[model samples]
Target chain A: MTQVSDAPAKTRAQISQKTLRTDRWWEQPAIVATLLTIWVTYATVHVFIGKWYWVPQYHYLTPFYSPCVSGECVPGAASLGTWFGHLPPIIPYAVVSLPFVLGFRLSCYYYRRAYYRAFWRAPAACAVREPHQKYTGETRFPLIMQNLHRYFFYMVILISILNTYDVIQAFHGKTGGIGFGLGTLIMLVNVVLLWCYSLSCHSCRHITGGRLKHFSKHPVRYWIWNRISWLNARHMQLAWTTLGTLMLTDLYIWLVAAHVFSDFRFYN
Target chain B: MSYKAALRVWRGDHGRGDLADYAVEVNEGEVVLDVLHRLQATQAGDLAIRWNCKAGKCGSCSMEINGRPRLACMTRMSTFTEDEVLTITPLRTFPVIRDLVTDVSFNYAKARQIPSFTPDPSVGLGEFRMQQADVERSQEFRKCIECYLCQNTCHVIRDHAENENAFAGPRFLMRVAELEMHPADTADRRDIAQDDFGLGFCNITKCCTEVCPEHIKITDNALIPLKERVAGRRYDPLVWLGSKIARRPRSTGTPKVPDNRH
Candidate 1:
């Protein structure tokens, strides 16, 4: 009979240095942190400001206040009738859909990597040590809620439908005829990018073709899954691009509503 | 067209280490491993490095060249500027065994944890059949060379040592993904993939894919599909209710009779 013994576990190299990577490993996480902070701050302030979110002339409603359900919403802005009475200023105008939108992005597979690296530093980058001694990842209570991404995805689709409706409504001319302006173009672009981001989602790809044991039996689903997989390959890029477009659309609407400048009207 | 290339190779063991610089001859069309081989032959013959086949296919000479995880056998010397100094280091994710060689037993341990392909016992060997599309779905992952580059580059285990116990890194998870997608594999791997193998830990950063010499879309094709499958089993309420109503018991050890109709 051969005898076997357990060997002592080997420890990592104790070089004292944090990381031996000579390259600028901090650059990516730093840039992500800066951009996400600016966007989140701008969004939080704007969501609470509750003013200059709607341009009544051209039916241009900022995404920040779309489906404006509160009584506090300005006249003509609450296209989807005000469902709630006047409330505290802390609450956003599109309170009904905002949480789901936030949840959708927050639980996104791509965004999860972004914030996990930038905010949590569960690892800032590959080969770089994170600050935390222990990492539970999304296996625990709060992080485990990330699994609810599919549920959040469903809600965001409904909100996006409302956003599409808002864009369609934004085609109003000053005299009630068809209107086409820079705001219309911006909102249109924003909604298109929004759809791209939503459709390219990992959850969307899975829901489309994941559980199917055979691809040949379900040709239509297989085709759709292939398209979604192509889009899903660029989910990270779409995730960031939509963020930029969302902010750009809102900023344009805000500026127009505040009379910062008139909408660049091509036809009215 | 040979030139004198300056090389900085990390020299040390598990306890401590530092970069030792040397000037070596680099011939045209040569690779980083070639220069290292010459260096090992002429000077510093005692220097330790792991390599075999000297070809990229073997996935043996994996190291960080200029801070990127790559197969040294595949990296050409001409990619860098003439004046640039080539810095070679061992994979950061594993404990160093010697100079440029890391103890990759972690991957072996992870590989051991995964249950082998559990084809239905009723289906005789060599009698199993599968659709070409289904075969192609997992063929991408079959190209893995066990380089451990993906395992080394994956941030879940690369940075977080504690995560080693939970996360199996991209390579093994890709293995699980491949087996799970196999038409004949009757093992119910969704729960183990989530609970044991740590599929939830992967954030789909594509680092594994980027480092893969095989270019096996480890993130997009394998990990994400596995995640969706796991989500179908665990998260989707309708799927859960359907399974329960259908009285389909979650099988663990026993392989289910293969359903050829799929």
Candidate 2:
């Protein structure tokens, strides 16, 4: 090993500085914005479609309509009792609980990084200036609502459980006998993916265990936290896929309800 | 076997230059810095590369090895195949003083921008006592050796020179995190962090974490948690109500504005 004295303390001129990347920096932010815009538009319009979120024949309720807490929910479609009475005109049962789910995503550390850059253009890319001059961060007003992410995480967990219940209920055929179909399999995939997205949250990881002083004292928690760390590494990937699977699950259910095609039943 | 490897080294100053090719002799278990030292010793006597503590601790030898910000002393040459030509360059975010050495005054400027720890005077100087657990949280961030690699790889300033005025990059944000985590520090830095230090500029990309030789969880443990703290206190309605209650004097019992008008 060379002696530390070998390292010279030569300070060169503070000449011009910048990256040599000739590639346009705007490309990344552009792609992120485009994808987010498409997803948001689809979700917004899909949620308010006010129909086709469930198929009683399969007992499969698309995630967006779960707990279908509206007086207007189709008979037998309301998984939980309607609190606000049947759906009020145009406002779907999903909208009531939608705020909590949306709040979870909005406050998500991962999604916050995404939309803040893509939509808000807060330094849209590395080394680029933000469109706006001021930044109070989440410390101010609505942005501060991000702190409510943990509370929203709890609601999402309950909703995920409800969706799981819906999937189990799918096992019961339309006539109330045990059955299986392709829709059941699709719904299964959707709920599992949603679990991955919800459970991999940093808040979840922290709750399972973080800020610990002694690992040996609480071996079980340490073990669980170790597993969560692995999932957290792929949180973004899982989050993105859950979005796709969710839309697919809903679309499949919608098609079944529309009689576009009958669900392929394997058992009855 | 002593084999010769092609090294495409960037050989110029801030104004201009291109990758200059060289055939350097390879030996067993040698890092990139060793090869550069040999290159300077036997061939390019004046070839400039900044380094200290060939053992990767000092962090004085940050450079772009194949376009990634890494310590020259730590990047093992064996990581590359014999036929592969290793491309060496200075960190892209800062101005180059010479080959493989960048002007890191930008980091020093940021360090100055952060307020130093302000202890509560009641505890008296050097009398402050922090619990073992309290100090451990901050110990994680104190590992920084000021390699500035995190600063360089941070995209916030790497591409946008315009962002230099606003963004403090990851290294300094972790610095602020360390201080704010201190049990004895009396200052409220939430405003300084988000508003002035550009804490909001970081989008938790983990680029800085990836390049940190210290392996600090810069994005997760530091930046994200800091954002939570700033938002948590303000967003909690209970805290809001508590603040409102604490504002009026408890001695007054009832809320009343004392008459000062004469």
TM-score of chain A of each: 0.95, 0.88
Candidate 1 Cα lDDT to native: 0.83
lDDT of 2 by residue, B73-181 (tens): 9988898889888877777777777887777877876676677776767887778655654566588898888999888877666655556766777888888877766
Superposition TM-score, candidate 2 onto the true structure? 0.73
Docking quality (DockQ) for each candidate: 0.37, 0.12
lDDT of each residue in B37-105, candidate 1, tens digit only: 999998889888899988789989999888788899999999987789888888887888889888887
lDDT string for model 1 (A36-65, tens) is 999999999899998999888899999988
Question: Which predicted model would earn the best lDDT?
Answer: 1
In candidate 2, position A118 carries an lDDT of 76
For the predicted complex of model 2, DockQ is 0.12
Off by over 4 Å in 2: A1-51, A67-72, A80-93, A112-158, A161-173, A177-196, A203-234, A244-248, A251-268, B1-4, B14-19, B81-85, B118-136, B183-187, B234-238, B245-262
